[model samples]
Target: MYAQCPDCLTVFSMDAETLAQARGHVVCGHCETEFDALASLSSQLPPEPFQQLPEHKSSGRPPQVESAVYRPRQESALAADSGTTPAAESEDFSHLVFSPRFARPAHQNRMRRWPWVLACLVLLLLLCAQLAWAKRDALVVDPTAGTLLRQACNSLGCRLPLVQDVQHLRLLARDVQAHPSVPGALLISATVRNDADFDQPWPVVVVTLSDVDGKHVAMRRLRPSEYLGDGFALQRGLPSGTSTALVLEVEDPGNKAVAFEFSFE
Candidate 1:
């Protein structure tokens, strides 16, 4: 019987012994491609296998070409020899097409991309949260951003520093005079007012004592605790649109200290 290699379409003789030994799987002798020989087994050749030359033939019959495979496009050239019909000409010959059996899998499953994108977004959000927490003190200066941060902090059970707006705070009044009981000392006092609608922390008072020539004589930076004691107002923050008194006593810079200036931070 005859068998055709499904890969290279090489036609060759097959026996029961060889078919049983390989389980109908045979390697093509012409192209060395391995395929199931039983898939395209046939009793005879083409419709014709290949072109037949008459000059090399001594007999009326065609030469026996062992490695030749059928090609229907060349069948009409040998029609007088095989006498094949039009019905046989339309038969399926798809098995004779060559295809690589060892390439890629036909049904491979791929990993989706959205999971990776979601992970990246989560990491980015975490980074932004960290940055916001680190700069919360600076962010509280903005009215809108501070409101959002305060609301978030309330829900998250976290506390943020009070809003400090130097522009909203100013000295309502100031006084500098000799200390009552202390010798060679001067007493400094100022009334600072908060103009904003919201309550804020007490500002650091920067006192600059200048000489008669308007040159700086002495400087002092006093925190709320230094001038106001450890009172509830220091922690609860100063009320809005109100004024607070500040008193401090310092050693006088001799008689050249004739002028003094006050600033708040």
Candidate 2:
């Protein structure tokens, strides 16, 4: 049967009977290479063992004798018998598995996905923080308005006289001129509108006047008037060349205040 050695590309023939009993091992005569001979020739042989031995070896030597065993052909003898080039019998196939090789570790593939997951988590946290800030009704006012009002009220103790018929309003501070001893009063007006649909009366405005040092010099609530026109007013005595900032706070029933400040030069 024709056989090719894996270690050395040598093609040789063996007796049909010896090949059947050889199992997988075969020894090459040219290169003396031992290889699995049955691997490549399994498809060419019959499934059952051969029943007869060669007729020539039965008479001189018993077919089962060691001398009757098959022998590999020498390199020179194989070339002479085939009448072919000696180099053609041996072929090289070492580069077949190495041509295109690509390998990667399993951990490296898993690590590459972590950056994308972290980026998505950071983006999700920032979006949630922005939504939380927007849901709050916190009010922020400029510091300049608070600084100016306190200075005017500290110098003059004049208080504006309260007019009745104003129920939901409380007079936090009223500064009015009392002859030449007090400076001319600066009048500040503030109003709060109950935009809610519920029929509930609640304090919605807080007006405060402070000194230049941010101390609360005068504070008042512009109570809701019975007539429902002007809610509250603050009158602060002002000397010549004196400036004051009037801070008006409008708060809903929920006690969330939105503030506005005006400067009287």
Candidate 3:
């Protein structure tokens, strides 16, 4: 029978009697390494026991080259003398045959991709959240988005920008004169208008009183409560395209209060 070496891949022939004497273990002639000869035996050999026979040449039949499949056998005396067991011998020959049961299935390989798929999905969700955070200012004007932002701000204890286009408040008219009731006091009158088509929050009005030289003498910042008074609810916001009158009395800065400027911030 022909035996091939697993280490050096050398093929050689040995008598079945000699192989049996060695307990299916033999040293390779080419590489001088010991291996189980029965594990590497070729299938081309006859299946019957080797016996005395005359050598002859075959003219018609072609040789069949096939792989050998190993089956477990009883422990031989040579293996027992060497302190080897049948379990060890069976393990040594386990690589001789290929079985469908021992092979991994395709579905099991597909299951291994689940973790990567889950990771990609989580990454996509994080990307969407980042985009929403970047566009938060533009989205805050929507009614539903404003409500959601307010609710989240309430829970998180953060401030929410619920309105947009509130900076459209325009300056309309201004009149500065001396106070009628108080002595040596000046009265400032102004009319502010909101040109925007939407109701918006009020802004802080800044008044700077300048002398004849254009140098500021007195400056005061008026809030919505000071100008609109308790009559109009400040939280109710300012109406669009409407005008409001403001009257403020301030102490005379001693120098002539001239060239006063009014601004809303």
- Highest TM-score model number: 1
Indicate the TM-score of model 3: 0.41
lDDT of 2 by residue, 128-147 (tens): 86874454222111134323
**Model 1: residues with Cα > 4 Å off, grouped in runs:** 1-125, 151-158, 163-165, 196-201, 231-242
Q: Rank order by lDDT, top first?
A: 1, 3, 2
TM-score of each: 0.47, 0.21, 0.41
**How large is the C-alpha RMSD of every model relative to the true structure?**
18.3, 23.0, 15.7
How many residue-pair clashes does candidate 1 contain? 0
How do the residues 1-265 of candidate 3 rate in per-residue lDDT, one tens digit apiece? 5776777866676665667679988998888999887775653544456332222335578778688655455567666888875554345642343324324467876788799999999999999889978887666656687668767877999765424464677777888788999998888888878776445677778889888998888898888787776655577576667988778877878756768898776
Q: Score candidate 1 by lDDT.
A: 0.75
TM-score of 2: 0.21
Cα error, candidate 3, residue 257 (Å): 1.9
lDDT tens digits, residues 1-265, model 1?
A: 5776655656687765677779988888888898777666655555564532111214678668888665456566566568864346466754443433332245421235567878999999999989987887677766788778778877999767777788889788999999999999889988888887456888888889998899998998888888877688789888778888889987888888889999887
- Clashes per candidate (backbone, < 3 Å): 0, 16, 0
Clashing pairs in 1: none
lDDT of each: 0.75, 0.42, 0.71
Runs in model 3 lying further than 4 Å from the true structure: 1-137, 140-167
Model 1, residue 34: displacement in angstroms? 30
